[model samples]
Target: MSKASRYEWRDQQASLQERMKGFMENPGTEQLQAVLTEMHAYAAAAQDGSIDIPERFIAFS
Candidate 1:
């Protein structure tokens, strides 16, 4: 993808995170754990090359 597109995806992910924060504002402990588990899966997928992280994230390195 183009650099601009990568940036856009990164922005979208950030926006998703913000939205999730609101959705989870009063989540129970189990719900919080589930969110964390999903996040870990997302990270693992990215690390395993099963998912492609946006260039903006790569650029952070």
Candidate 2:
């Protein structure tokens, strides 16, 4: 990947980590696991250039 793309990916990964942190702090194990599973799917889609950021942003918000 280009340097900028790599940086953007890193930012997205950090955002995912922050989201996971919030979920972990307030949710039960099963909920947190579910979030993690969704996160993995998101990451995979992102890596494949298939992530719909606008849609995901709305869903996440």
TM-score of each: 0.51, 0.50
Error of 2 at 27 (Å): 1.0
Q: Model 2: per-residue lDDT, tens digit, 1-61?
A: 5556555755776677777777878788876876788698777977789543433222253
* Top-TM-score structure, candidate number: 1
Local error of candidate 1 at residue 12 (angstroms)? 11
Residues 20-55, candidate 1: write the lDDT tens digits: 685578677766766676577667766776545654
Any idea what lDDT model 1 has?
A: 0.63
Worst 10 residues of 1 by lDDT: 52-61
Q: How many clashes in each structure?
A: 0, 0
Q: How close is candidate 2 to the true structure, as a TM-score?
A: 0.50
